[model samples]
Target: MRKQHIKSHPVASLYVENQSWLRGWLYRKVGCTHLAADLVQDTFERLLKRESYGDVEKSGAYLKTTARNLVIDHWRRKALEAAYMEALHIQGEAYHPSPEEQHMHLDLLNRIDQVVQRLPVQTRQVFLRVQLEGWGYAKVAESLGISVSTVKRHLKAALLECCFYCE
Candidate 1:
């Protein structure tokens, strides 16, 4: 059996020696174990492909500074996502009106109905025909066989009565 000797690359040796220290430093600085591990792995991966680092004088400082910038970017993205979620939560809350608000709206409509019922027959008819049925003044006047002025007078009186009763 023949034994073969392999040469170790200087860059790979330095990476192995410093990885543990780098991981610990990154965890303390970023306050996140998982992110620290990820950044350290990414830095080494980038070192393999990066051609412009050009025999860096202080590789440790370069790694630490790069890790810090990565952490800052991560925090910025987290903040933006948090704000987006808060906006969505507010919009979802608004999409469904509160039960109390729905009840209040129903109560107001019922009160209006009761007030219209209490009016005189002609006034109730005029109010319902014009307001509830959405008929124009001329159409209501023709249907009731009254002049437009008479229809307007009835509507005004009905509105006043409604306001008085509602209060």
Candidate 2:
């Protein structure tokens, strides 16, 4: 059974009170007013889709966190697209996947990114260094100041999470 939701802070009230501040807040981090405004709209749309803001005691803080996350997501997506384009460039047009395959690959990448983002902070860090940066376990452990065993543990956890989503 779903827990009943009550809108202690109605989304309109929250939007009216927060949009300008949130936009500025996002702009500071993103350095683009248009992008900030777009993120602000997306942020509120997020709240709108929720059953409720529920019992949020500090709505501004919550909004800031949410907005910050959106900015991070925006950057991550940009980086991912750049990398995909770079890979395609390396492969050349003749080797390119069909549009359908390209879309499927992007969707999978997004889903895997979401999984990585959901990982515990330390685990995510370890996973990125090893997988994205091509760092070995020893190198990641040394750089992170953790034991090789600990690095292996984090990688194992990350791989298990990814594999769970795989066929």
Candidate 3:
């Protein structure tokens, strides 16, 4: 088979220009060289998939924003995984899942996490408060300084997003 030459994307230039700076910023935020490198790669990958880079004048700002979101996502996933592991630990040895089942559960959790990350911030917070933390809608609204109806709306949006992910 002949190897095909792949054209470099426009984002390639952006990556070449900003990779080091972005990685350094991420390293300062995350305090891990390896994780920062991974996040830099993810940031560019996300940029490549975006429909438009928006204003060329603000490309650097866009890149930084994307990288910052990636860092937040990394932390959120880490926290979710930690919570999952803690739950499993609390279940004790009596609740052993087969390896395959465990893998499936983790995969499902990752899918759920991806869906949650795509949600609007307020909706995500409302969903997490009501579902994960077992808070009532009223409590979430009170804490978030929103009305109960607004909380319900956010939860509905979040659930719809989850349903879309499952499909």
Top TM-score model? 3
* lDDT at 155, model 2: 95
Q: Write the per-residue lDDT of candidate 3 for residues 106-166, one digit (tens) a residue.
A: 7778888899878989999999999999999889999999999999999999999898887
List clash counts for every candidate, in order. Answer: 0, 0, 0
TM-score of 2: 0.68
The lDDT of model 3 is: 0.85
Off by over 4 Å in 3: 1-9, 54-58, 114-130, 133-157
- Candidate 2, 1-167: lDDT as tens digits: 23233344477667777899889989999999999999999988877777756754346887787888899899998888788878999999778998899878877787789899999999999999999999998989989899999999999999999889753
Query: After superposition on all CA atoms, what RMSD does each candidate show versus the true structure?
Result: 25.5, 5.2, 4.1
Q: Per-candidate TM vs. native?
A: 0.46, 0.68, 0.70
The residue pairs that clash in candidate 2, if any, are: none
Q: Sort the predicted structures by lDDT, highest score first.
A: 2, 3, 1
lDDT of 2 at 45: 80
Each prediction's whole-model lDDT (CA)? 0.74, 0.85, 0.85
